[model samples]
Target: MDLSNIDLSKFDGLAFIWLDIETITGTGVYDTLSSPDTWFVHKNPDVCEDFICSDLKNKQIFLITSGSLGHKIIKSIHHLPQLHSVYIYCQDIARHTPLASEFKKIRSVCNKTQSLISQLAIDVAHICVNIGDQHSRLNKHKQALVWYERAFEKIKQHNGLTKNEFVNALKSKINISTLECQRFQQHRQQLGEGMNEVKYQHELLRQLLDVPTPLSSTEKDDKHIAATIKKIDEWERKNIQQIKTVAERVRQQLQKQINEINKVNKVKHDFRLINDELRQRQSEDDYVEADLQQWLERLQQLKHQLETTTISDTSQIDVQITDDIDWSSMVKLVESDVSKTWVRTREISMVESL
Candidate 1:
C-alpha cells in the first residue's frame, strides 16, 4: 500500500488519523463497526480510555477507522490540529489500504511548495537588483558600487545565482564609477585660472582716463588758459594719486577676497565630494541638511561684501563758464562820408560870407 495514494481534497475541512496494527507478519489490516465512543477505543484502545476519563484539556486528537467504525472516527476528527495534517495522516492509513488516488494528491502539494520556493527566489533577486540600480542612478558612484556588490553577494549567497551573474553586476558598477570619475576630473580641469576682479576694475578705470577730450578755442587764452592748465595739471596729479591709492587698496581687497573665495571654494568642493560619497551611503534628507549649512555660510559672506562696499556717485569734470568765454570787448573806429560832406559844405558857406 502506498501512503502517497490518498486524495487531500476529500478531507479539506475534515480531520482523521491512522492506526497501525502490527502482527507477526509486521502488517495487518482489518475493518470494524462501532459507535463514536466505541470507535475511539478500537482505534486507540490504550489511550482512548485514559483520554475519555481525563479532561482532554486543549489537546486535540484524530482517530481514523475502517468500515463500520469510520463514521465514529470522522466525528472526533474535528478535534485535530488542522485539516492538512489530518489528510496527511489519512494518506498514511491508505498505505495499508493501498490506493492510486492518494499518491496523486501528495504529488500536487509537493509541486505547489516547489513553485512557491522558486517564485520567492526570483523576487529576492529582483529586489536586490532594484536597490542597486537606484543607488547607482543617484550619482553616488562609490555607494552605488557598494550596493551593487552587496546585492551580488546576497544573490550568490542566498539565491544560488551563477558566478557569471555576480561578475556581470560587479563590472557594471565599476564601469559607472569609472565614467563618473573621468567626468569629475574633466570638470575640475575646465575651471582653470580665475579672473582677478580688482585688476580688471583698475584697468577699466585707466582706459577711461586715457580717453582724450577735445579742447575748446577759448581755452587757448594766455592768462585764463595758463591758470586753467595749471589747475588741470594739479587736479590730474591729485586725482591720479588718489586713483593709484584707491587702485592699490582695491587690488589688495580683491586679492584678499579672491584668496578667501578660493579657500572657501576648495573646502566646499572637498565637502561636496564627501557629501556625494556620504549620500550614496546615507539618506537624501541627511545630505540636504549638510549641504544647506555650507551654502548658508557662503551666502553670509556674500552679504557682508554687499554691505561693506559703498557705492558712490561718479565725479565728472565741470568746465567753468568763465573758462569757456573771453570777457574783454574790442571796438574799431571808422570815418563816415556824411561827416566829411558836412564839413566841406560848412567851409563853402563861410567863404561865400567873406
Candidate 2:
C-alpha cells in the first residue's frame, strides 16, 4: 500500500496510526477515534517505519499496535522523535506490561477495546497540555495560549476525563492567559494596539474564571468540604451494611453448629432412663433370654450413638480484619505534575479503595 496517498499534513491537529498484523475491524476503535486524522496499517512494520520517516517526519505520531507487533517493532521505532506515544492493544495485559515498562513512550497496555479508546482520548488531551506547558516554560506566551486552548477544548469533548482533570485543564488555560495578559501590560506603552489585546485577554480570563458561580474562595472551599463529607458518609454507610450482612451469616452458621451439639446432649440424657428401666426389670425378677437380649441390644445402640456423634470445633471459625484504607488522605488535596495527564491525578476526598 502507498502511504503517500494519505496526507497527514492536511489535518490541523493530531494524527494517529494503528499498526497490527491483521486489519482491525468491528472493534469500534476506528469509530471511537477521529477517522479523518487516523490511518490503519497492517502486517508491514518496514513500510510503517518508512512511512513515519519519509512522510510523517515533521508531524508527531501516536501509534497503536498489537502486543506481538509492538514487541517486534518498538525497538526499531521507539527512538523516532515523531513517535510521541505507543499503545499496546492485546488480549493479555500482563504479558505486554513488562514490554511497556521498558519504553517510556508506551503509555498503556490495554486488554479491553474500550479501555484503549478511553486512554487514547486522554493521552491526546494530555499531549496538548504538555505541549502548552513546554511553550509556557520557554516564555512563548502566544504559542502556549493556543496549545492550552486546544487542551481545554479536548478535555471538554472527552467525557472520560474526571471533574478534577477538567478543572485542572481549565486552570492551566487560565494561568497561561494570565501570563499573556501580564506580558501585554509590559508592552502596552510601546505598542499602540496592545491595550486592545489586553482588554480582550482580560475578558477571556473573566469568562474562564467564572466557574459555576461568583462565590468567594472561602465559600467554594466550604462547599467542596461539605461535598467530601457527604461522600465519606455514603462510604461509611455502605461498609457498615456489608459488615452487618457478614456478621449475620456467621451468627447463623454458629447457631447451626450449636443445634447439632444440643441433639447429642439429648441422647446422653436418655441413657439415665434406660438404666432405670433395666434396674426395675431386674428387681421384679423378670428374667428371660429374650428380655436380656433386648436390654443388651438397647444399651449397645445408645453406646454407638455416643461414640459416633462428633462435634465440630468452634475454634476453626475465625474472622479476619484488615485495615488497609487511608481515609484521611482524601481530605488533603495536593497539586502535583499535571503534565502526566495519563496518570489519574488524586483529588481531594477521593476514596480510591472503594
User: Please, what is the whole-model Cα lDDT of each candidate in the order they appear?
Assistant: 0.41, 0.71
Tell me the spans in candidate 1 whose CA falls farther than 4 Å from its real position.
Answer: 1-121, 163-170, 178-354
* lDDT at 296, model 1: 65
TM-score of each: 0.21, 0.43
Those runs of model 2 whose alpha carbons end farther than 4 Å from true positions after fitting are 1-14, 26-42, 137-139, 165-170, 178-354
Q: How accurate locally is residue 22 in candidate 1, as Cα lDDT from 0 to 100?
A: 20
lDDT measured at residue 316 in model 1 versus the true structure, 0 to 100: 29
Clashing pairs in model 2, backbone N/Cα/C closer than 3 A: 330-349
Per-residue lDDT over 222-259 for candidate 2, one digit per residue giving the tens place of the 0 to 100 score: 88779988877777788789879988998897787777
Worst 10 contiguous positions by lDDT, candidate 1: 345-354
The candidate that achieves the highest TM-score relative to the unseen native structure: 2
Model 1, 108-190: lDDT tens digits are 11123233233333333443344456555666565556545544554454445555764576667757776876786676566
